[model samples]
Target: MGDITGDTRLQSRILEDVGAASHYRAWLVSLALDALGDEPVEIGSGHGDYAAEWLPHARSFTATDADESRVAFLKERFAGDSRVRVRKLLLPSTLDGGFSSAVAYNVLEHIPDDVAALRSMAAMVRPGGAVIVFVPAFPLLMSDFDRAVGHVRRYRRASLRKAFEDAGLRPRVLKHVNWAGFFAWLLMMRLLRGVPRDSLALRTYDRLIVPAVRASERLMAPPFGQSLLAIADV
Candidate 1:
């Protein structure tokens, strides 16, 4: 949600046309959901791109966004779904504690005060609960696409781990994802300064390369990637 920035319609289209990208995202969500309880919360649920996969597993799910427009869209998207609730919540939100788990994907880089945001996220969960986060990796890979997407900075493993520790969350798992995507992003977005959009090249990458890269990561994760994910405990 926080990762792809643009008009809401444009964002939805981007997610839809990206083909196999959705599978990779569902894999990440599955990893996060492993540690989650029945009642979970998703922060920055833009357009609910991954909602369909996550919703059925939750006893109750709260999808929150900083943008009122996005919240409205989510409200309509989940309308009449008894298990789901949509709300507008700008971070450092006044959210209460005791949720089974908290999750955010591609969100930390969007906030200027990412540590504070992590702290706020941790506060929403109960003791011994999980807080899963996924964020873009490597500041050097940043470009106009990242800027347009409202990314302040990308993360390294250490930086992300530090943020979790500072937030009073115990860092449990950290791994890089999408090995091929690292170089592809650098060449397309950084060196070439490509603008964000849905395209045949991206579709090919997602459809062909993504599955291969994911399969490789199962044996041993790459040292660097286009993004990093962490599973922390509160």
Candidate 2:
């Protein structure tokens, strides 16, 4: 539910993205929901969809974005919630929030210097805290939509681990998710020409298709997937 720093593609579609894939976004949130320790800070917390879902489980949550408009939206959206704080954050920060957990979902791929970005997230967290990162995976699956969406690079599990290690964090939970999504992206995005907007087709996939993938992966972890989720310790 967050944005990538320095990436403005589909900037105006932040809310649309949240609305279109409501179920899908919820699926993404569920992966890291339990790992989010107290006093969590989420980077690039776009329109705050993930924040809204995760906040009820956390003691305190900070939602941040590089885009001012999205920051404003998050602030207004969470103004009544005392446990939530919204702010504008740029990458390579010196922030020291001492958060128990820091997270970035579909955010790090937009940063060219992902290791430095991970470091920035790690800096905000206290020792023994968690830094949970989720990003699109598989370079072969890179499509026109990914470029149009301003993704710098996709990640593999090993590379993602290296990034965490480079950022001086210890990776604990590293896994591939969305087993079927790898093939779906290959056919729909790589072979297809355009970016997908909010549509019944997406909603249908989110509802009918995604659950089966989630269920299968939960039963047995896939060797590779459409995305990599890494939970590291500071």
In model 2, how large is the Cα lDDT of residue 115?
85
TM-score, cand. 2: 0.93
Kindly list the per-residue Cα lDDT of model 2 for residues 45-162, writing each as its tens digit. 8778889899888989999988878888898999999999888887778788999898998888888888898888888889888889999999998887788767888998888989
Model 1: lowest-lDDT 10 consecutive positions? 1-10
C-alpha RMSD (angstroms) for model 2: 2.5
Question: What tens-digit string does per-residue lDDT give for candidate 1 at 175-221?
Answer: 88888888988998899987555677766766777778888888997
Against the hidden true structure, what lDDT does model 1 obtain? Answer: 0.79
Q: Each prediction's TM-score against the native?
A: 0.90, 0.93
- Candidate 2 achieves a global lDDT of 0.83
Q: Residue 198 deviation, candidate 2, in Å? A: 1.4
Which clashing pairs does model 2 show?
2-46
The models' CA-based lDDT, in order, is 0.79, 0.83
